[model samples]
Target: MKAPYIFNIQKFSVHDGPGIRTTIFFKGCPIRCLWCHNPESQKYNQEVMLTSEGEEEIVGQHYTIEQIVKKVQSDQIFYDQSGGGVTFSGGEVMTQPIDYIVELASRIKRLGISLMIDTCGVAPVENYQKILPYADGFLYDLKFINSQDHFKYVGKDNSLVKDNLKFISDNGGAIYLRLILLKGINDSMDTMEKTVEWLKENNIKISEIDLLPYHDFGRDKYNRLGRKCTQNFEVPDEQHVLNIKYYLQQEGYNVKIGG
Candidate 1:
């Protein structure tokens, strides 16, 4: 009754969170960001992917909370060793049935394992409120500050996003703000300053700011779907990131590359 339209399950991912983790990538997103690396995750329905052998539909066996716990517990040895547990990524994790997210997160918390959610913060505050108690930390993504820029590039105005971030921060949500460094899109000093200003205005002390470099991983998928790929924008080199970091540091904010 509470099944989510899930797409992929990745095991042993280190880059997503602390130590080793199993990331559950759910399906469906409200905003279609041009630079999304996982374009396959944009749809709510299960999609078919071609493999060497044949076609593969992404729908798999659904696991209940207890069932999923077994798989997560199997990684307990790793969890104990690396301080990693599970991360709920998505199309948008909060976009799923709140009951499902709450049930799953509550179970994981009961296990004393660290649970994290990587969100675009486009969903309702009630959704965030439901999962906030269970989350040990949040990987909060902020793409653009200007409403029009956000609408053009990300396909949605960010007023709700801003409110959600403020809501979470005001309620004492432990968060690491994630900003993707796109060459011509969000890398300008004006955009960066606006982002910094938003953070400052919220009185949110950044635990860390992860500057993600845009890549072209989703180009082939877009091609396969018969859709024109648009996120092939240039990426900032290491030096460029360094300059941005210097600017953030000068503003009294600590910055880092990659979350």
Candidate 2:
């Protein structure tokens, strides 16, 4: 496979996974999440955008697997010291070049560097199967239990997501569930109840659950990219977020507030 366009290489990211880690943010996503903070990650090709300060910027760069491995290799010491490694985030890492992802994962494992795929969970099951052995865990995002809501907000069918999640869990891959909470859309108690029911029904094994509340942090980026900044989603209140977390905790889940 040829080189792939990656949007960002964020170093020392603590929230993506365990410990301080380097995060590989690839360009291009399968879903168009309304509250996505990284608007630059939505497109596959390189493009120019105006920054907040009105500065012109070009996003996306082609990177070879060897160059990326070398970059992450520099952080090996940090990974060893802090239980931190590399997180392959996106755009949607799973939907990117599978050959690149598989090869990079193999190299990362060969180097003994821990690997995690922060995914939106909308890719083929075979993609998950390819990296199952190399990945330490997955940061799997579950946006909505309702198919309509998922398609309306996220712009795709979620059956594939659910199927892939179950596939990963059943295949013995560690799953760190990420729940995106949009007030009045998917942050209701009914949704939570059904979520618990779904998890129980499928027997999904989750190492942890991250409750990600809605935020308009990337609203301005839309304007910079010459796109609409639609504020269709509202941020879940503090107590509401806590309530969801509390309810999930009651359901015997290892739940946390953020990813």
Clashing pairs in model 1, backbone N/Cα/C closer than 3 A = none
RMSD of each predicted structure = 1.7, 1.1
Provide the global lDDT of candidate 1 against the true structure. Answer: 0.83
User: What's each prediction's TM-score?
Assistant: 0.94, 0.97
- Give lDDT tens digits, candidate 1, residues 150-254: 899888899988898888888888888888888977898888888888788878766778788887776777656556777758878788888888899899876
Per-residue lDDT of model 2, residues 78-112, tens digit only? 99999999999989888888988899999999999
- Looking at model 1, which ten-residue stretch has the lowest summed lDDT? 52-61
lDDT of 2 at 99: 89
RMSD of 2: 1.1
lDDT of 2 at 145: 90
